[model samples]
Target: MALAKGTRLGPYEILSFIGAGGMGDVYRAWDTRLERDVAIKVLAERLACEPRSLARFRTEAKSIAALSHPNILSIYDAELEHPPLFLVTELLEGVTLRQQIGRSAIPWRRAVQIGSEVADGLATAHDARIIHRDLKPENIFVTARGAIKILDFGLARFKPAFQGKPGSRATTVSEGGSLMGTVGYLAPEQARGETVTAATDIFSLGCVLYEMVSGHRAFNLASPASTLAAILNDDPRPVADYVADVPEELDRWIGHCLRKDEKARPQSARDLGLVLRDLLAEPTAHGRTGAEFESLAVLPFFTSASSPDAEYLADGITETLINQFAQLQHLRVIARSTVFRHKGKDADPIELGRELAVSAVLTGRIFQRGDVLVIAAELINVRDGLHLWGQQYKRPLTDIFAIEEDISREISERLRVRFAPREQSRLVKRYTESPKAYQLYLKGRFLWNKRAIESMRQALRYFEQAVEEDASYARAYAGLADCTSMLAIYGALDPRLGGKRARAAQEMALQIDPDLSEAYASRGFSLLLFDWKFREAESVLRHAVHLNSGDAPAHQWLGFALGLTGQLEEARGAMRIAQQLDPFSASINTTAVFPVYWAHLFEEAIEGFRAAVELHPGYWMAHYYMGLTYAHKGEFGQAILALRHAAEIGDSIWRYSGLGYVYAQAGRPQQARSVLKKLDELGRHQYVPLIYSAAVYAGLGETDQAVEWLRRAAEQRDWMIAWLHVDPIWDSIRSDPRLQGIRVDLGPKP
Candidate 1:
């Protein structure tokens, strides 16, 4: 069906021929119904006669229609059942990449940007469980605006385990036994008739990128067979050979992508996109190109407002910007916890930068008047206290997101940071259209960061309100899960019920946005604290860390999981990473005490907790843990004083239990009995971790009573029981035969 100008196909009037391909002919057309220009791709009659070919064509239309991404070509409609079947897509004014790459080399920066955009599109498609098996220059378009758009998913397939390694080499042919994809860009596994995964697309993109930068195909030969052989066995010429100024890092990245073993290639298209963007961001000085160690800290925005709500808004802006910067994998952004330590302190930018070990510091002053917000921010070079970039944004409250985007973009420009397309979108991505919902979400996050029982409850209210305003807000759901689980862990809610709610909220978050690393980390916490599923918790937490290396909480939770499983040394490594990511975070700093305490290094645990106290003397958890470490070392007097101080700061069953245990150990029977009575009374009125009661009894040397409480704790599924293998508090009860049975039941099942 070669449609001449003025031909009508249903509601579309063909105006001119665009081009023809093996599968179809493309015609520029006008969609009368929508009154818009569209490109119509009509399947060739000869190919349409074959059921398998028609099916593949229809699949392409449907696959593309299901996707919504800037880099992906947009599909409007598909006519499958009617004769002269065709697909409608947005009319793009651009040349196919093949034409754009015609016999000339593209600048390295432009090439990287094009490749990064393509990788971002591939990553989106993979997330939708669709694999673009045909990735080549001919299938990509470079719009007049310089944006890259991927075309032709004609060889796309559905693979739910799309992110996993490719299937075995034996399963290459489609159901109809047709070989798919082009030869030149075929991954080595694909060339060998082996199954392909996202890595296949990555390899293809690498070939395309190499051609773009070098003005030659990466693995072309005199014959198709020879080209396939090159793809399967030979390495392409180093990119630097063609482009003298090409960075060694870029060559290494492309080489990794072109590896013969698909398993050895970049496993994630998103990660590859980040690497490409990093290459563009890497500074070149004196003819040297390498990663610039440009770390930055975002100081909490200063506000002179008397209203607490105004202060919250200022804090939220700082945090949101910090989060936005953290998403740029090429940028080293100090965590909010570490940076907020400078809140209200008039610290010099260079000194603060030295404290945070960042190359630069971002400081801002926020003011609100009626419905308007005024923010003045400046980026300062830490080495010399020199201002690098500064801006003042005065906008309506509803335009807060726009302000953030403008700030982020300007900062990235000044810092020489290049973000992948996805990252660029995420830096300004608004999760809710409603400003109220966004505000509530911000407030929830602010409260949640306080990490107190009452604050968590308040955060829960705000999070619920945020979701009520915007049901699709994934971050709000993640916050909901975090608060719900923390309530249970802190004994503010029933363990069983809190765990169930937390899991449900976490599932909702993942369903809305599976890429949210915070949701996965929160789920890992629920798994560990509620279900006591140590192995599954470890798996989820590790995946969270893999997704976002800068996620301090994920690393912290992974360390917690490792500590519970008795992997002391590995736990220490994870904790160290967490501490580096969040140097001043009291919670993260206190995490080190656990592995040291479990390893029975009482002195180290005490020292670690004391150091945490010095960093945050008001952090009750630090004082509480320090008390436990002291008790373990038989310093009962110091333990009692520390525990009492912790109780004064924030009273909890753990504090009472620690106090009781120390008193008992110090031969103060009356005080120990009184503390036990108080715990009993509190248990009747509020939720209490049975572990606390058991600990008190164990400290009193009451074997039968301790075993009884331990049994109850097991029946109730107390989360602390998961640490039975390594908990130093359980050492006294371990020798008791009945306690051994309880320990066995709590241990990982064979």
Candidate 2:
């Protein structure tokens, strides 16, 4: 009854069975003649004997083979044979939407986008008079590129094949089945055994969208009869009730799709797709926006200073002014890391505008002699390379804060950007007046943005030096908090000491200036990583965003906080905004590593790290995350390669433990044990390493030894404990009483 390895069907050599269901068995097969991989679906011999079932199978094959859309699965060939009748379709690598929904609900925008594509595919099929009677979550697949495709047209009905006239005959029902579609997703008319139409497919797609947004099916019933009764008599729960963050306008659109009466629903799939696209096109409405120009890019200032230190200071000034205005929602300032790339180059303003995708670019020149500071700035329209506004500031050396505020206000007013009253007050509050301290703080931030352990340490040195020079420099304190928090996360500093210093720095910053949003984001990240106080971290991160809507780091930190709290949908949205603000940022991409690691989605994390490494090959943290992702996915050889690469870049002690797990998994127990010994010799055999050793033992099938190490990891409060419940690598030991005890000891899920 089952297709075994080496089984030959038609022109394909079946490699192995992939999966099976009531309809047929799917196999990973080799197309010997074509020399390529293909999925072969073979109908059961019993089903093939039934004339009606055989006709439906052939009709499905023919229907899909004729109608081709990018979002619809392609049917390659069909064969009618003596033993097994088979249909071959394109093989896809990624999981289905059904699997995705099991982990977390898709964001409203992404859900709408996927829904729109599915509708487009179905509308194409419907135009050709083909109706997919069964449309469910399992039938919709998401590709590696994040595109959607509809699969399994096994039950599709073709009107042209059944009738001779165009829209002249009423639709007919097949006699083989009573209930035509999946129970929970069945349309009302379809459940009542009425003629199937395009409206039926539209209703079913609406159910899929509802499931994607709410993480639940539209209907709940035990049997087909019960499901039919509910479909006829009951109203589906409003989507807003389940996902409160979804816009009300989106809820209204979905509500229309799920209407019980056929006429009340969308007239066609094409019409429904347009509505969904419109929903996704709406700008995010959940947060506050600044009153002034919401987005701006600060170009490198023109400077002819002979001293490199002065050149650095001039660049720092440009950065400082950009950071100052970044807080206002009305002004969206491009991150310094992205704009600074064009420094010292003759870049056309219009070309820079097109590349940076900003409406305006601000360029400036600075000249400082003795205690006198002179600066000139101009805002240029990127589209036309014309000056929008210009200003000149002459200030005493001690009044640098006044200079920064004056420049920021001029830019804001020239752009006519609106600011909230509270935001205006915060933007006006000067953190310090010392030019020397401000220069040091800016240099520290610039190095910190490099996101490497050595750079972060150097940045911390400068920040601490700035604070020592002037204790009341609030921005310097904020920079210190950021560096310390990052050091703890990267395992470059002791969590206890780093967290204490980070908190102290943040407290001092806020004490001196409560309007410092970067300090809040920094402190929030520290709380999330060290204290594991998720609620407090989320509160602080939200406050950071509210205080400074244009702060990319604040939104980035907020994304991490939400992800830590298992609010993945909102986390994804926040992450999107961060990416938009810093599109070329290595640091922003690396941030995904921690959240994905904590979430135990090692495969996704591995792909993300690979992308990050490609973007910045010198980034050791990306290599480290890649090693972890490989270790989780059971690719020990690749894991070792990545971990070794990380160690080669910088001897990070964290990779030693990960390498131990990879060694054990690859069946090199001696190497694994030796790595553990080396870790002990280095005095880095902490809880994380112990957990890795436990996983290595488990991989070696040493249950008792694995349990012993797991116990140690739990007692030490190892971070990996958070993923114990869902990590697939531990599936072998999950049933053990010792592992269950360890899970309970680690406290409830975060």
Candidate 3:
């Protein structure tokens, strides 16, 4: 019987009922003294009065109270002196393993992970000579963070019970002659009602592993008696029958656990844990761990005999395949921005892989006929430049959806990745049935990736058409949000108006598909740039990474959020991960240089930004950042040259501002004032960031004029104001009275 809400047992006050089970009723209770939520497991009133049941409850507490492990539930306190006889434990926030299994069959890799953690927990208890007789899905909990916890140690028996005498330190309880464990998970020895040891727990864990991987009970039958009899007499069905393509090694391992003879079963839980770890870390043919070899890059496909309109078609196919690979949890796909850097460049596979830090490269060619598409794709091993897999497909243009699915499946097979059914479905999930809408969405993405104001505005139009073509296009809405935020950040649109549009588009994207990782990323960037909601940005960006760890922009944005909070080390770590995922991306590379520069590593920043400039010689931002680094080091000549190149490559207010600031610092006030005049004249006709004018004034030591412009910049919501606290460029004005309270006016650190 569940305790009613507000029921009080000792210092624990029941807030709500959590669940009820055969052993006890669990309630969500608040520990008054500690002011923390706890789970109270209360035995039934009838069981509380039975002498045997009371002894068992006390024994269970004493056994668990002596053990301490992260994966094992802790007994906080026991109220046995009172009639209800309740035990309190930490309140866990997650679904039970039984509920998880009910949702979908667990992937084999995930099953191994869950089982390995559970085995480690069991080994800890076994070290103290305790054996869990009831290890089943209902008793295993999977936390939101993927951590596994073993529950219901109350049904456990001390290992010394097998020797006919309990250990001196072990608490003794009656081993009733009735069935004590779930029939589906019973060990052969438990079925025979014989003395059980640590081996009994091993057997039960095997049953759990089989069910987790195969989604079927190992010994399920028409009745409980038949299930118990099958456990002692019949073997579980072959795992391959339930799960195709299970690794041969895993099959053998699970079989060893299910051996009816106790002597043939795995000897110890510790040894089993070691075996599972080895299986997970096994090296592939490339002589690296399976995970290391899973790195991949999909290069832009070469278009053959294609018209201008068909150019987007070829690139769209490659982009679609790259996106499909992203859904594979086992594969680390390089971001499209990085891979596209190699477009139209003749780079060797090995060289590209070394530069990108990936083990494989996917390259292909696409040719379009009137209503047909011919695609030839190959996966090359970067170590030896060997072709691991290659395929050619000629399909109706409308069949591009199925072609994407086929290519994804072949790549997974060649790479030795075994996707669970849910993963397979997600990898090929169709967001839109309209080819026209998908093509429009792809064109919009193509333009959005350019990151220019006009290009983004054009992308917004394409996305609008895409949504009109198919009202349920989630990615198109995400693109809409992305373009809208960039418009606000670049000062092309009013921040207040653009922020509302971006939020609405992102919200619509999530409404269509709640698990869209890209939508979360777009929302995160909008929050960071337009809303200045750093905490919300961090939360959504973290969720984006959790959904797709290979998302380079999410990692980069998360780094920005972390950096704003002064977590410089953590921020650098996240940026490094982004660099790994998108090494050749000019924006990612430029952003990576900032944290190093902010940390006052000017020398490192110069070297890194210089390399980025060399890698993408025409990438204006690299030169812009290199100029800033040189200016900080007082290398006026080099800084002028770099800033001049940035201006010549693309004229922008910030570039001219950098040029003017360098000129003034170099003792050329005439040139600096001339550049400021140019900015002032340009501001009359076009939008010029107020911070640019302020930088020039700051450089010329015009304190009043500088502060005036800075005030206008803050009022206008300039995005560059985010660097006010740490930017060395503002050091000259740091001690000014007007700048004293400005940080409080600006948003929080990040």
Candidate 4:
């Protein structure tokens, strides 16, 4: 399909032949309508004649249009309606990389620059779910202005996903296979004709990068078949082996991209680009590069507003940024519970970063006047206290989403932490388009974090109003589910309500956004406590944590579900992650120690509990749990002291009944009876879970009374009944027929 000079197709005149390839023939052409010089890729005869191939080519050409990166050759149009099918693209004035690299091996830094540019183009396409099946030096052009442009994107599919020629390793795959990549640069999975992903392009890019630095093919052998085998089974020689003064880190980083297991490769092109760019920045940044994971702490945004609603706006900014940053797999964002602890203390960003042991700290001040918001943000490098990035944004409140997106993008660019597609979507995901609904949701979250009974009620009201304002808001529904679950957990509401109100809210949230991990976490809580579906609870909780690994509460809940079902080691592991993410949370720390306490590792549990207690001395929940752990350790005097401290802090059923149970465990029958009597009088006026009384009865060795009370507790749908299958307090009446019957009625089958 060679076109002669002066041949006209549609409005474009083929002025001269440029080159030829398997997919098409390139020609210098005149665009009559746009009155400009352009490059035209005239399709091969087989592709032009086949309707299916033509349609597929047209569809993929549109996908390529989404990638308008400077490093990517711009496609002007896919001319399909004309007799001859062709693609119009930007003309280039530089030699192919194959010609340029033929002179000599490129310098390491220059090679890194080229690789970074290629990666930036790949990132844009990959983020749009487009895969470049073939990438080689000949397909990369180095312009006269020193810029690189990727050629023939989405054109590899003209033959197969790898197109090879028998006995010729010029640039194609073997003849017998349907594979489509150039033989030497084919990724292992592509060589095997397996399904491709964004990682496949990463492997090909690594081969190109290897060639740039070493001035030779990454895996050239005696034949294309031999090269394919090498790609599948062998590691390329390190760039340093072939070139002088190439850093070992650069070699290792390339090796990560060339890994045979695609899973081991960099998950996203943008992430790898950032790593390479950082390596390039090492000389000026005091010779530093990111370690395993870059850690960051986003301190709570300071505010000038006095009203609670206006303050909620500031809290929203801090929380939104933290959630977005946490989604990056290569970044460890400090949890909200930890960062919010220094909210009003005016902590220095440098000091906070050092205290949290993170690479950087992000501090912000937010001021809202009427409908306008003014935000000043700064990202400081912890080591030298240099401002990595800083910006001030003044925008109408209605455009908060755009403002946040710009801030997030700028920060990630400065920090060299780019998000994968999934993470990018999560970062810019707008739960509600309406600014009013967003404000209501933020107020709801602020109230929910307070964790008080009355505040939770207030949070519920706000969440309901948020959804009323925008019925399609998934986050508002997630908030409803979380608030309702907390009320049920604290015995402030009937456990039966979890199956009704909480269940509906969770289902609605999932319906709107099926990947909402927090909603899944709330559903797991209900299944564990109210439905007596222990196995289902653990499965749902596991899925929740899988969706969002940074979710401390999800990990904490999963730990409880695992510990109660006798999976002590796994429970301890989950809790450890929760504790790591939320270091300053008293409840998280105490529950993080729960699996150890339940495993009867008394000394270990004692150490864990004491550490948590010391960190949060005023948290009564920690003191109460320490008492139970001491009782199990047979330290009766210390147990009594802990329980007394718990009772002195709060006189609720948790602390009061817990004291009675510990008193009986210590053999103080008279004191235990007095506490039980006090509970009995109080139960007459309020809704007290009989399970609390049952706990004291079990400790006192009153078998019949405990069994009767357990039956009543099961009838009332009390949450504590779920622990019957695991709690050691019930070991005394382990074989009682009445207790077994109650367990059958209340617990899941082991």
Candidate 5:
């Protein structure tokens, strides 16, 4: 019988039923005795009445109650009553690892950390001779504090089995004469009916870890029998086959744990825990650095001076120092626009670090008196709230550039960074000798970093004005290149004209000072997007990093190029570096957008765009992407809302096709027809617009109209055909012969 809300069981008062599974029915309950919330897992009525099963359940509860690791869910009470046999556990407010994995694969560092914690909890349990018979993603919970907790110890087993209770009906045999655990995750020995040991848990943990990394099951099959067959006869595809970036050593280690023979696996959970703990301790042990040094946020320098002009000069000096440091290849320097958020605020470094997910933070103060400048800089380690480095610089105003260089060199040295020759040159080159022009250039960069079309135009104006003020200003030309490149990207400028201008601006900037890495990054974007010279784009993007290892924009653009070229792992690594540099940046928040979009990962694109919009509400482009994602997902109302918001924010009409398609599909045929009519009236309905119309019409079951529009789209040679195989929206029409013909006409598969 189902328990109703408010039902009392032992000392717990039932609040509401949460869920029920094969093992038990979970309920949200109030621990009246303890005055706190708890979750009560009551065994099935039949199982509860079975004396032997109840005895085993009690035994398992006692076994779990003894383990006290923070990562293991605490069991508060276990009781037997007339109606229900239940175990009360501390209530968790967060979702399970299963839910998170289904949403999206966790980052490698986070996965490792979570896995390590799980291993630690298992170690504690295994030390007490308790083994979890079932270990899967569903049993791992992530708390709001970002800690991992292992649950479901109510099914765990201890050594030395006892006899069944009097009048008990429970037997040792599993249902269906199969393994007791979930099929895909069961250990080989368990499946073969062999007695389970701690190694079985380790083997199951290996499967969980593998799924976390690869986003697929280790023993996937069409049926239970087939799944069992694979478990007995097959070896899983190497983890590296699915995710190329997984380190070989880590893969081998996990493989060892998944060995068919229990003895071949780790001897105990404690041994596996030790290995994971050691991996966590070594920053670069797995041939990757885990989460260390991914990004840095450089807070604007606070000035003690009262004069506004003096403060501006101090700010300019700070920017110059940042620019110089940004030339280092391994450091991603958060652009000034993003870093300014912390200006003048008494920010807690640790809180900021956690929020931003950056490894280090740089903050300082500057003072100007007459012809002298006094600057103090400090780097704080975010993890430990410890000061990693600090320096005080007092120098003549005339030698401000030298002071900036000295600061960069010292920081790099302290961080054990080795600068490439191009990076060294970029760091040493003075952008402008005139203080006014330098200040104007800094202001221009700050505006350009906003990444909005209007901001780009304003930034271009500032750059032009700066150049007029100082003809030899290399940084101003770099600023112009950045602005023009952004305009070209958003379709705000005709590629033919904008590409030429961007190329000219970048070339001029490099001619003025060949060491300007930002100029090269801009040039790379132009080449990649307009010139379509993939090789040249790759070379330039690589050189940009070589020229300025610390330049966050270089890493960002490089990631973009690599992603477009299908080098996803390398692209993600580059983006990770960019994210590390500017954890809170609007651009960084949306870094995954370009990758997902280019790869036609529509679902991931939708999620990335949503995350971006949440992080920076003013980013109209994010809204635009969200609309595109919604259109692809067949969520027409949401698509229209997002598109309208983008339009209200004055976004360009480049996303019209997506908006029009969604409108048509959402039963707003008149509105879609009107938009298409308007586009035709404006002579702006391109191949993509026609193709989108085809999809919308097809979704509305207007087959003939869909075919006609698709023919037009095919005639015009829509570029998106390269993604047809993977595009989810096309699923509705993929089976139609006409659609197949169009696919053939578009050339071989993308």
Candidate 6:
């Protein structure tokens, strides 16, 4: 029975018929819960109504659902309690491999690539003792972006193994049954009605690979009867006979798969796939193969949307892609902070590549046209300035996931950068299936990067909306946590309130996805600030870096934690890696001076802050730190100027705190009192950080009040309380009993 459009089956609305097959009729459908397109295959009545077939279908479906390989069509849902038994899978867009080959014979190298991908998917299935008894090109799909997906993973088990005549379909009996398979490609034992194993599928794959390059069936004869006889008694003509230029190794590989003795053939699909992939491992004519391709720079993608909102969208895309590429093993992808500084510059790709000292440069343009998002990318070689590979994708906005996956994988393939299987599996790993949630998260990140009071607040709202849309979105939760904690760090919110919210969100994020590296980094920062647990924070931050060495923030946090413990050399090493990973980030460049300033290297720290200000002149973070360093060096004039600039540029509590501290240190006690009066007015409307009062008091030689305020700062979980050991401002009252007690209560920074 054909289900008409709008027909509902278990929350899936049938949109239209996709195709009909012996197993069932496939329909394009919408999954109401996920709000995404899906393909539903309703079993044919013959198989649906048969008790034996129905029982086996459940077993096979359950097994197939457990296999998660990229090359296999994903099974989302399986219903079998009643009639109309069906399975749901991700909808694909492309021709079948049969259609691709029918149009023309593929080159031997291309054929090898296809075969290797197929065996990779099969290897996962075989590991679970679930073989695709019917391994043929007709059951293989070639996605639009050239990905190979194995189709009909377990459908062959839904009925009698076989039934037909010579020159027609084959036949097999019921009871003590095996998975269904085609006769022309069957192994010798399977053809003799004997026990079939994974080796049987290997033999079938040999036949398919043979035809891919030779354009002829491996065992065709005068009749199907003769074909079966040949399978039992003979081997087909050597593949080299059909194509003289075919590699000799491929002929031997096929010969091994067709061995009459089952044990003599390759024992597993995994081994066969590795063998096939190894054939393509030789260096390509135009590009580097291994370490050479590791040095890459993914420049900020340009956008043509002509609006501030679209500008954020473009930057979000570039950053997301950089993060994705950074996880690939052996690839030293340029971090977003560094590459984004070059955005909108009209420099040549090759010139930028040479300046960045990278082997290749990936430049891209994103054009938004209503519902369609056009993304064009080109990878150019630095050594020769040749276009190694390029592609333009004009797809619906919802296809962003597919587009990114294709671009990353294609580049990895083009560059011949090999990754272990586990790493490869994570290359396109998604944090959320909801496109709406993902977009909102991107916007949240874009706004959060602005590092202003209002922008951070606005970013929190977007992140909250994203989590509401998809509660399982760990990355969104991580964003919400980071934003919340930053508000406290900047003194916009009370530390108690902000830390509570941040910890709650961070816990949820980790619970949802434990391996999420950013969430771990966020937790590490909270531990240092709110709990003053430097050792625990350092270990957690190190694990975060271990999870993703490309996560620059992880390295930066590790440096900060190490610096507080007086591990100067180790702290500088971590900061250097962070700088190497994200060299141009004003935040990074400024924070990197923390150890230098703490070690009393005032001149060096001032130079570092100056470098950061030159990179981003308006960045208040650099100016604020610069003022602190100059005051410690007794350069009161320059110190006051930096603090004034910081106050003018930013709208945060730090805007005036540093200035007030400098005034007291310069013996302008009256001006310092006026600044404290201003703070008193501001306190009526917000939670003012106690550190501001402590710093000013310490500078004024009021040791008792300074220590009392320092105690209060520690009690309130102030963001800067950990600086007690490093800030020279605190040294004046180091002998105060209350300050010593506060330091002991804070549990060891040094």
Candidate 3 on 222-265: residue-level lDDT in tens? 99988888988999888989999678798789989999988898
Please provide, for model 6 over 296-338, each residue's C-alpha lDDT reduced to its tens digit, 9 standing for 90 to 100: 8999887752333456668877888788878776888888878
- How high is the lDDT of residue 313 in model 1? 88
Highest TM-score: which candidate? 6
Candidate 2: segments with Cα more than 4 A from true spot: 1-294, 302-305, 341-346, 365-376, 391-396, 593-607, 684-750
lDDT of 6 at 520: 93
For this target, which candidate reaches the highest lDDT against the unseen true structure?
1
Residues 1-750, model 5: lDDT tens digits: 668988998778999988887667889999775566788988888887667567657766787678766567868787765556788887777789999898997654456556766777787787776778778999898754344678776567675431223442222236547456778888887778767777778888999888888888899899988998898888899988989877676778788888998789888676676576455445674775433564566677877533334566656666776676665666656666566767777566557766766677777767677787767676665765434445556677667677777767666654555566566666666778886687678678666756677888888898988999998888788788777766755546655566677788888888998766778888887766656554567778899877666667778878866765667777888988877666556776676566666566778888888988998888676887788678776777788999778767744545565566677678888877776766566456321235656655665667777778877755543433433544455666667787666542211212
Cα lDDT of all candidates, in order?
Answer: 0.82, 0.74, 0.80, 0.80, 0.70, 0.81
List ranges where model 1 is wrong by over 4 Å: 1-285, 288-293, 306-308, 418-421, 735-750
Tens-digit per-residue lDDT, 1-750, candidate 4: 589999987888899999887667899999887666789888888787776567646755776677666677878777777667888887788788899888766777778878887888887777666677888898889865355788866543322222123432222233545566678998998888766777888999999999888887889999988998999999988888888888888999999999999989998899988888777667534555532228899998887533334688888888989988887877888899899889988456778889999988888767677788867676767765544555557689998988888888877877877566688778778888998899898999998987777889899999999999999998899899888877876766766765578899988999999998889999998888877777788889989878888888899999888887888898889988998998998889988887877676779888988998999898788898888888877888998999899888753566777788888989999999998898798778866778888889988989899999998988877888888876666767767888666542224423
Off by over 4 Å in 6: 1-292, 306-308, 743-750
- How many backbone overlaps does candidate 4 show? 7
Task: Write candidate 2's Cα lDDT for 140-203 as tens digits.
Answer: 9976434467887768877754223455332334565556568888788777676667877888
lDDT of 2 at 372: 72
Candidate with more favorable, higher lDDT: 2 or 6: 6
Candidate number with the higher lDDT (1 or 3): 1
Please report, as a residue range, the 10-residue window in candidate 3 with the lowest summed lDDT.
166-175
For candidate 1, write residues 468-508 as lDDT tens digits.
99999999999999998888777778777888888899999
TM-score for each predicted model, relative to the true structure: 0.61, 0.54, 0.59, 0.61, 0.49, 0.62
